[model samples]
Structures are given as C-alpha cells and as structure tokens.
Target: MTRRLLLSYLGLALLVLAGLEIPLGWIYARGETARFSQSVERDASMLAEVTEENIEEGKTAELPAVIGEYAAESGGRVIVVDRKGIVLADSGAGSAAGPATRPGTDLSREPDIAAALRNQTTVTTRTCTEGGEVLSATLPGSSGTTVRGALRLTYPMTTVTDRVHRVWLALALAGACVLAAVALVAFTLARWITRPLRTLERATTQLAAGHLANPPDATTGPPELRSLATSFTRTATRLQHLLKAQHAFAAEASHQLKTPLTALRLRLENFEPYLDPRAHASLDETIEEVERLGRMVQGLLALARLENTATTPEPVDLDAVVAERVAMWEPLAAEQYVALAVTGVPAGQVWAIPGALEQIIDNLLANALRVSPPGSTLTLARAPGTELHVIDQGPGMSPADRERAFDRFWRASDSHHDGTGLGLPIVRHLTHASGGEITLHAAPGGGLTARVRLRPAGPPPRRLARRPHTAAPSHGSTSATVPGERAGG
Candidate 1:
C-alpha cells in the first residue's frame, strides 16, 4: 500500500510537469528564435542605410572595410548587391574566408537578397554548407523610395539554439527536484496512514491465540483505522471476560453438582438395607440412575472446560498412544469376551492439544468397547498418514444418525444403551481444537468405524524421550465414554 501510494503521487506529479513544461519549453524556444531574428533585422537596417549613402556617393568599392568591422564584431556574413542583381562585396573579401561567397559573386538571386531589392525587409532561416544553419535578415538600401542596392546579413542558428537548449535543461532539472520532493512527502504520508493498520494486524493475531497480549494504539493513523482499532480492542476484552466466566462456571457447577449426586447415591444405598426384598431392586436401580446422572455432570463439565480453554497443538506419537491405549483397555475387552487389538501401519508424530489426544482416544475406545458384541473384535488402528481409526464390530449408526452424532446430547433414536450422548461431541471438540476433524463411516465388516483425522506434527522433537501416559461420561462408567454415547454440560 505504501508503494502504491508513492507511485500514485509520482504519477500525478509527472503528469503536471509534462503539462506545464512541454508548452513552456516550446514557447521559450520559439521566443528565442523570434528575438534573434529581430536583433538581426535591426542590425541589417542600419547597415542598409549606410549602403544607400555609399552607393549614392560612388564609394561602393569601399563597402568592404565599412561592413568588415561590424561583421567581425557580430560574427556574421554580409552581402551588398547592385541594382542590376550582382554582388558588390562579400564579408569574406580579401582573406582566407571560411566558405563565404567572395566579392563580385551574384547574391542577387538569393531569396532574401531578391526580396530586399524589391524594397522589402525580411528575415528567414536556411541551411547552407558554408554557414551550417543560416538566419538571414535582408532590407533595401533606399533613398527616397529609389532603391540603391540591398544589404543582406546571415548569422548561424547555434547562437539562439544553444540558449534554448539551456532553458530545456533547466526545466528538466527543476522537474526532477519537484518529483523528489513529492516522493519524500508521499512516503511520509503513506507511512502515517498505515502504521495503525500494522499494529492492528499484530493485535488480531494475538487475540486469535486466546488472548490479546498487547492492544493496538487507537490514537494514531486515519480516523477510520483508529475507530476500527478501538472497536477491536473492546471486542477482544469482552470475549476474554466471557471465556473466564465460562471456565469459572464449569468449575463451580461440576463441584456443586457432584456433591449432591454423591449424597443422593449414599442415601439410596442406605434405604436398600431397610427396604424389603422387592424394594432392593428398586433401590439399586435408583442408585445406579443417580450415579449415571453424576457421570453426565462430569461429561458436561469436561466439554465446558474443553470449550473454554485455548490449547495450542503439540507433537504426539500416534503409534505409541494407540499401542498404550489398546494395552490398557485389553483386560476390559477380555472380560467382556471381546478382542481389543491394534492394527494398521504406524503413524508417526501428529499435532494435538497436549492432553486432548489421550482424552479423545479414551472416549472412542470406551464407546467402541461398550458397543462391541461378545467375541467381536475391537481395533485401535493408525493409518499411514495422520489418521487414527477405531473399528468396532458393533451396531453401527445410520447415515442420518452419523450426521447428527456430533451434536450435543444427540443420541440415535433406536439407541437402547444408557449413554447421555456427549462422547462423540467431546471427541469432535478435541479434534477441532487440535486443528483436525472427525468423521463417522460404516465399518468395513458389520460395525462402526470412527475415523479421527489429525494434523501431522512433522518430525518428532529431538528433546523428548518415550513417555508412559494416562477418563469419561455416563452409564456409571468410570471412563469418559458410556453405552449410549452420552456427554454432559
């Protein structure tokens, strides 16, 4: 923008200079030529009067000495023609002349000389071998309207042309100076206009990174940019406050809800011993429901925390995480008569929010394990790129259910399990925060395949060593995932 502004200023200045300088130069050149011609005419008129007096006094042969002094002083050639159209004298008379026509030469046929004999005074320029470019002024040598002879004077055009050249050179130098001044002023103006915008740009990048570290100054730049900076600062401040409030609510609400649900479960368990045999089942069911509600509350808070925080992605080894998770869930799968297996080529490092990959894998594995039938295979697979696939030999969701699965608390209509339906949404939030996406496709066999796409973390970091690592939602499940794929606040 600054460059463009400078160019525009230079372009306008050039146009102005061309408009003024071109005409001024041309007029100056023409005026110089006219002035030179007039000066030549004045000199020629005085000499013509002298020629008339000499011819009347029969002293024509002495014309050379009389005109020689004037010709030497003025740096020009002179010619005196008789009434019969013959040359009486030439300026180059008795010396080694430089290409000038000598004495007794006929200059009567020359255009200016012929016009002079016709009693006319005239000035014209012509090119000639002897004089290069010639400016000639001629007038009649007349006494009482009877022409005695004619006098013609010629000067080289370089005398006037050199002055015109100097004037054009001066104009060129002046124009250059003006353009330089415009460039300096334009540069200053452009920088002034764009300084605030650059500051605003940096401020916006900081805001996107979860907080605005340094706000832009609204006191500089144009009024429009200043107003924009002020508005952006205000908006970023409000958003920060809103995020802080949300985190506070998530923490407070999780604590507030967990205590009462635990007390209620204890009260229901107490009632179990006093109640009859038939009431035992009812008390147990009530206790289980209360526990499920508690898990739902936890899932909700986890999601709230995920939404409220800004997490930058870091490199995590996908293969290592998958192997570890499968090992941890293997015992659980075995007890349920299902096989927990890891397959597919090793995907190297991938970028994910620090704790997010572990949480996502936990939720998906927990969900897949719950839905897998007895003796079915549950696979934690890593594709060649930055994808993790959890294939479960469970009842897969329909197309419509899959599309809406990521919605908060959205369970399939035919879902019979006790899930609160927050698992998939949480997984999606974690994936997006890590700069990736999640999609559900039908499993290759007769199950569901949850395909988790992630950003490649490039090469693994040089400083880290292999590290060992480490929860979930509803159905009273200790882990984050529940049977009905439920989640909470």
Candidate 2:
C-alpha cells in the first residue's frame, strides 16, 4: 500500500511538470528564432541605405569595401545587384576592387533579391549548398524613389539554433531539479499517511491472537485514522468485558449447581435401601439419570475453564495416552461383552493442551461402548497424519446427523445411548482450541467412526518409557486380543 501511494504521487507530479514545461519550451524557442530574424533584417536595411547613397554619388567603387567591412563585423555575406539581375559588388574572394568591374552570378532570379528589386524588403530562410541553413534578408537600394540595386545579407542559422538549444537545456535541468524535490515531498507525505495504517495492522494482528490486554494507541496520525484507532480500542475493551462476563456466568452456574446435585445424589442413595425389590430397578434408573446430569454439568465446567484460560499446546504421546485410556475403560467394555481393541501405528506424538487429549479419548470411548453390541469389537486406532479414530461396530448416523454432530446439545433422533449431547461438542471445541480438527463418519464395515486430527509435535522424548500394549482383564476373563505387533490390534 505504501509503495502504491508513492507511485501515485510521483505520477501526478510528472504529469504536472509535462503540462507546464512543454508549451513554455516551444514558445521560448519560437521567440528566439523570431528575434534573430528581426536583427538580420535591421542590419540589411542599414546596409541598403548606405549603398543607395553611394549609387546616387556614382561612387560604386567604395561599395565592395563597405560591404566587406560589414560582412566581417557581422559574420555574414553581402552582395549588391543592379536591376539587370547581375551582381555588381560581391563580398567574395578576388572582389578586392568591386564585383561591378568583374560581375558574378545573376541575382534577379533569386526570390528575396527579386522582391527587393521591386522596392520590397524580404527576409527568408533556406538551406545553403555549402552546408548549414542560412537566413537571407534582401533590401532595395533606392536613389530618390528609383530602385537602382539590391543589398542581400545572409547569416548562418546555427547561432539562432544554438541559443534555443541552450535555453531548452537549462529548462530541462530546472525541471529535473523540481521533479526530484516533488518526489521527495510526495514520498514523505505518503509515509505520513500510511504510518498510522501500519500501526493499526499490527494492533489488529495482536487482537486476533487473543492479546487484547493492551490496546493500540489512538493518539497519532490524522483525525480519521485516530478516530478509527480509538473505535477499535473501545470495541476490543467491550469484547473483553463481554467474554469475562460470559466465562464468569458459566463458572458460577456450574459451581452453584454442583452442591444441589451432590445433595440430591446423597438423598437418592439413602432412599435406595428403603425401596422394595421391584422398585429397586426404578431407583437405579433414577440414579443413572442423576449421574448423567452430573457428568453434563462437569463437562460444561470444563468447557468454561478451557474458554477462560488460553493454554498453549505441548508435545504429547498419542499412543501412550490412547493406551492408558483404553486400559481404564476396558472393564466396562468387558462387562458389556464388547471387545475393546487397540490398533494402528504405535508411539506417535502430537501437540495438544495438557488434559484435552485425555478428555477427548474418554468421551469418544464412552460413546462407542454405549452403542456397541455384545461380541462386537470397538477399535481405538491411530491413523496416519497425527490422527486418531474410534471405530465401533454399532448403528451409525445419517449425513444430516453428522453435519450437526458438533453443535452443542444436539443429538440424533434415533440415538441409542443416553448421552447429554455435550460430549461431541466439547471434543470439537477442544480440537479447534488445540488447532486440530474432529470429524464423524460411518466406519468401513459398520457403525460410527470418530476421527480426530491433531498437529504433530515430532517424536516423543527419548527418556520417556514405552508401555506394553495390554488391556486390564475384567472378572478374570481374557477375551480381548492385541493382534499383530505391527498392526497393534
């Protein structure tokens, strides 16, 4: 933008200079040429008057001497011609006496000389056979109203052209100096205009990066830019306040609800022993619903905490985290008669917030297990490109459900699990917050697949110990399998 502004200013300056300098230069050259022609005509008229006097006195012998002296002084050639179109006195070599005694070429046919013989003074410009151009002025020599001869003076045009060229050269130099100064001023003005915009750009970048604690200064530059900067600072302050209020509300609501939920759970536990055997099933169902609500509240609190705190991602062992989560959830899978398996590449590392990976794995595993049929396998796999996939052999969702899967409190109409619907939304938020992506798709064979792609953090530290791939056995049963060592299933 700065470069564009500078070019625009320089272009305008050049246009102005061209408009002003071109016509003035042409006029100067024309005036100089006209002045030179006038001077030559005046000299020719004076010489013609002197020759007329000599012709009336019949002292034509002194004509050559007079003409030669004038020619030498004025740097021009002179000639005297009678009405008969014959040169009588010539300012040429061997004319030491007078050309009247040894006449030269006829001048009656020459245009300017012919006009002069008719008593009319004429000045004209024409090329010379010898070389350069010449300006010729002819004046009639009259002896008391009778034209006797003509005086023709010729001056080289080179002197006039040289003078015009010098004037043009000086103008060119002056124009260049003015243009240089204009360019310098234009550049300074452009920088002045863009400096504030550059500062605003840097401030905008910082704001986008969540560094709104220090707003940009609004006191510099023109009034428009200053006003814009002030507006941005105010808007950023208002946004900061709004976010703080939202986070405060979420944290307060979650904390406030926890006490009553705990009290209710305690009351339900106390009343469970007094219920009859037939009613015990209903009590257990109520307890489960209460537990689900408690988990939903906890998820909300965790999400609120994540939103309020800006946590930078760090290196984490994807395989190690997955293996640990699988072991923890293995007992529940076994109780449901679902085979829990670990598969895909081993020892992969990714960058994620400290506890985000664990929460995501736990939620996905819980969701998968809840829908898996007995004897069906639930695979916890690490795919290429720093991705993790939880595949379950259960009923999958339609495309419409997958599209809104990340929306908070959204659930499929035919969903079999009793979930609060916050699990997937939390997973999505955490994934994005860590600069990753989460997606749901239908597994290859059957059921749903939850895929999480994360940013890789290179290899794990060498000091970190590798854990053996094994799931905790439930009730002494060993139905789960760790396939080929390379396949890791």
Candidate 3:
C-alpha cells in the first residue's frame, strides 16, 4: 500500500513537470533564436550602409578590409557580392584582396542573398552540408537609390542552441529536486497512515488467541481510524464480560446442585433395603439415572472451569498416562471378554494441561469399552509428533456421523449404548484449549481410531532398560476402576 501510494504521488509529479516544462522550453528556444537573428540583421544593415558609401567614393577596394575587421570581432564570415551575382571579396579567404571566387560558392544562389538582391533585407537559418547549423542575414548595399551589392553576415547556430540546452538542463535539475521532495513527503505520509493499522492488527491477533487483557489504543491516527479502534476495544470488552458471566453461572449452578444430588442419592441408598424385588430393579434404574444427571452436571462444570481458567502447559508422561488408564480399564475389559493392549514408545513426554491427558484417555477408553464386542481388542499406542492413538475393534461411525460427532448431545442411532453424548465434545474443547488436536478415523480392519496430537514439552525422564511391551485383559469376570467415565458409559 505504501509503495502504491508513493508511486501515485511520483506519477502526478512527473505529469505536472511534463505539462509545464515542454512548452516553456520551446518558447525560450524560439525567443532566443529570434533575438539573436534580429541583432545580426541590424549589424548587417549598418555594414551595408558603410559599403555603399565606400563604393560611391570610388574606394570599393577598401570595403574588404572593413568587412573583415567587423567579421573578426563578431565571430562570423562576411561576403561582398556585386549586382551581377558574382563575389567581389570574401573575408574568410584571409586577405580580402580582390574578386575571389571559389567553386560552387555562388552567393546569388543563397536564399538570404537572393532576397537582398531584390532590394529586401533578410535573415534565415539553415543546416550546412557539413551537418552544422548556421544563421545568415543579408542587407542590400544602395548607392543613392541604385543597388550596388549585397553584404551578407553568417554565424554558427550552436550559440543559440547551446543557450537553449542549458536552460532545459536547469529546468530538469529543478524538476528532479521537486520530485525528490515529493517522494520523501509521500513516504512519510504513508508510514503515518499505516502505523496505526499495523498496531491494530497485532492487537486483534492477540485477542483472537485468547489474550484480551490489553486492547488497542484509539487515540492514534486520523479520526476514522481512531473511531474504528474505539469500536473494536468496546466489542472486545463486552465479549469478555459476557463470557465471564456465562462461566460464572455454569460453575455456580453445577457446584450448588452437587450437595442436593448427593443427599438424594444417599437417601435412596438407605431406602433400598426395604424396597420389594420389583421395586428394587426400578430403584436401581432410578439410581443410575441420578448418577447420570450428576455426571452431566459435573461435565458442564468442568467445561466451564476449562473456559474460565488459563492452564499453563507442562511436560506430561504420555506412556505413563496411557498405561495407567489401560490398567484401570483392564478389569472391565476382562469382564466383557475383550482384550486391552498398549504399544509404541514407553517413555515419551508431551506438553499439556495437568490432568488433561488422563481425562482424555479415560473418556476414550470408556467409549471404546461400551461399544466394543467380546474378543475384540482395544489398542493404545504412542506415535511420533507427540501423538496418541486409541484403536477399538468396534462398529465405527460413518463420515457424516464423524463430522457431527463433536457436537454436544449428538449420538449414533445404531449404537446400543446409553450415554449423555458430551464426551467427545468435551475432549475436543479440552484438546483445543491445550493447543492440541483430536481426530477420529476408520481403523485398518474395522472399527475406529481416536488420534490425538499434543505439543512436546521436553524429553522424558531417563528410566531403566527399555523394551516393547503390551497389556491384555486376564481371563475373568471383573470390573475396572473408571476415572471420569460416567458420561460415555
């Protein structure tokens, strides 16, 4: 933008200079030529009068010496021609003694001399055969009304041309100086105009990255730019306030409901022993419903806290996190007659919020266990680029279902599982907040693979000898200790 603006300014300067300098230069050249011609003609006329007097007094031989002297002083060539169109004397032949005729040097054939022979004074300019320009002036010599001869004066046109060239050179220099000044002014103005916009751009980027503590200043630049900055700052402030209110309401509501829900669950458990067999089954369902509601409230509160809190990243043990989560789910895997295994690097560190890795693994494992059939395998692996993958041999979702899988309260219709549907959405929000990514893809054979990429913080702590290892569920009917697994199971 600055370059374009400066170019436009220079273009206008060039246009204006061309408009003014061209005609003015031509006028100066014409005026100088006319003035020089007029002066030469006057000198020629005076010499003609002197020559006429000399002829009448019978001293025509002395005419050559006088004309030669005048020609030498004026830096010109002078020729004396009789009325018969023949050269009487030539100053350029050095002696100016007598009728000196050079081949092809007939004075009568020259335009200016021809005009003078007709009793008219003439001044003209022409290019010589030698490729230089000359100005010639001719005056008729009259002896008491009878034409005696013609006195012609010739001078090189370089004198007038050089003068005109010098004038144009000076104009060119002045125009260059003006253009330089204009370029400097234009550059300064462009900088002044864009500086504020650059500042605002940086501020806007920070805001989008969740850094809203400092807003752009509105007091710089022109009035329109200032107004734009002011509006942006106001909008950011309002958005910040509205988000704060929303988080506060979510946290407060979730925290307040926990006490009542816990008390109700305790009362229900105490009354369970007196309930009939049929009523017991209904009470168990009620208890499960209450637990599901409690988990939903807790999930909402967790999401709100994640939004409200700014968690600084730190190095977490990826291998350790996956191993621990799989261990906790091993009992449930055995009870379902499913195999749980882990592979890849056993000691890798990734940058993530504290406890976030554990929650992600817990939720993914829960979802896999609920859908995975007996004899199927659940594989947890750590790949390069700080990536983790959980592959389950279960019925996976279609492309369209996967696209909407991250939306809260969305579930597959063909699934036989009961879930609140907030698991994947919460995982997505948490992963994004920690500057990571999560994606779902079809497994190699059949089923789904959850791929997660987290930022690397640093190298893992050195441990003992390393070796490839895997964990599979033991043969038994059992249950596993689940962490944050209520929503998906």
Best model number under lDDT = 1
Which of the predicted structures, 1 or 3, would earn the higher TM-score when compared with the native?
1
Better structure of 1 and 2 per TM-score:
1
Q: Tens-digit lDDT track for model 1 on 1-489? A: 889889998999999999999999999999999999999999999998998899989999899988888888888888888876688877863222246666677777777778878888888888766546778788899987799899888888888989999999999999999999999999999899988888898888887766688998899999999999999899999998997787788768976999899998888887877789988887877877787688678777766666655545788888887776667777777888988788887788888767677777777877887788998998877786678888998888788888888887777777666677777787887787777889988998778888999878865332211111114222224443434472220
* lDDT of each residue in 1-489, candidate 2, tens digit only: 778987897788788888888888899889988999999999988999998888778888898899989877767888888776688787753222223224667868878888888889888888776657888898999866699889888788887899888888988898889889977887888777777787778777766765575566577667898888899888988887887898799889987988899899899999987989899889888988887677667656766766666656668898888887788778878899998898887747787766677767766776777678899999988888988998999877777788887776666776545566676776676677666899889999889898999988954322211111123433321111111100000
> Which pairs of residues clash in candidate 2, taking residues 3 or more apart in a chain or in different chains?
88-100, 483-489
Worst 10 residues of 2 by lDDT: 480-489
| Predictions: Cα RMSD each | 5.7, 8.1, 7.4
Better of 2 and 3 by TM-score: 3
Best-performing candidate as measured by TM-score: 1
lDDT of candidates 1 onward, in order:
0.78, 0.74, 0.74
Decreasing TM-score order of the candidates: 1, 3, 2
